[model samples]
Target: MHSLNDLLESFHLYAECERCQRSMQLSVEKLIARLGNDFPVTDLRPRLRCTGCNIRGQDLRIVFVGPPGKRMVFQYRR
Candidate 1:
């Protein structure tokens, strides 16, 4: 069980909708600032909502994207 603090660096959080298959990047810093650093990563499953399909419960993906300027792939959104 990894906490938000554990993945603050060298990682990115993404929430994907099971129904519509839409994925969006979540801000770890914003989450930590709001939910605190000890917030469990697994606990975000039920809290996530899909903007595309308007459904509850999203599949969380923790991807290692490395530090800034290393490997830029997905764009982070709010």
Candidate 2:
């Protein structure tokens, strides 16, 4: 199954350099933990903008899938 974390692994926005293979897979695991194992997130969106710049560059987008194919985005609220 294609997990959100798997998608994140390929994202370059979080990469410090070209040689680094983004291994922040735990973000997916933690998000799942918060949602509970019973709940499964299926998809994630494109890379979002960075804090330093308004550019929608490399970043993680987690799409928490719910019942009946519903989708909820996980992001920090200010």
Candidate 3:
């Protein structure tokens, strides 16, 4: 399984709030600062919150953005 560090280094982070459906893009550097480098990518849903609705982290859905015209190389389930 790929770790957060690996995902961040390889792809972009797309986070959506379950409440208001608000979305945000996060970069590897930013995520590292917020969640540390060793965190697992699959475990990020419970650690994100919607800035608009102020929803808790558990209600967030996280997706990985791969290169242009390419499907995600890594498989992560929500």
The TM-score leader among the candidates is 1
lDDT of 2 by residue, 1-78 (tens): 544444333322121112232323235455555655444333222233334444433334333333334444443211
Q: Which scores greater on lDDT, model 2 or model 3?
A: 3
Q: Quote the positional error of residue 50 for candidate 1 in Å.
A: 0.5
Q: Candidate 3 — which residues are off by over 4 angstroms?
A: 58-77
Looking at model 1, residue 40 earns an lDDT score of 93
* Candidate 1 weakest lDDT stretch, 10 residues: 69-78
User: Which residue pairs show backbone clashes in model 3?
Assistant: none
RMSD of each: 4.5, 12.2, 3.6
lDDT tens digits, residue span 24-46, model 3: 87676877788788888767777
Give the alpha-carbon lDDT of every model: 0.85, 0.36, 0.67
In candidate 2, the residue pairs with backbone N, CA or C atoms under 3 Å apart (3 or more residues apart, or in different chains) clash, namely 13-58
Model 2 bad stretches (over 4 Å): 5-26, 29-45, 59-78
lDDT of 1 at 28: 95
Model 1, C-alpha of 61: deviation from truth (Å): 0.9
Q: Count the backbone clashes (under 3 Å) in each candidate.
A: 0, 1, 0
Better of 2 and 3 by TM-score: 3
Regarding lDDT, does 1 or 3 come out ahead?
1
Q: Work out the TM-score per prediction.
A: 0.81, 0.26, 0.65
Which number leads on lDDT?
1
Looking at model 1, residue 75 earns an lDDT score of 47
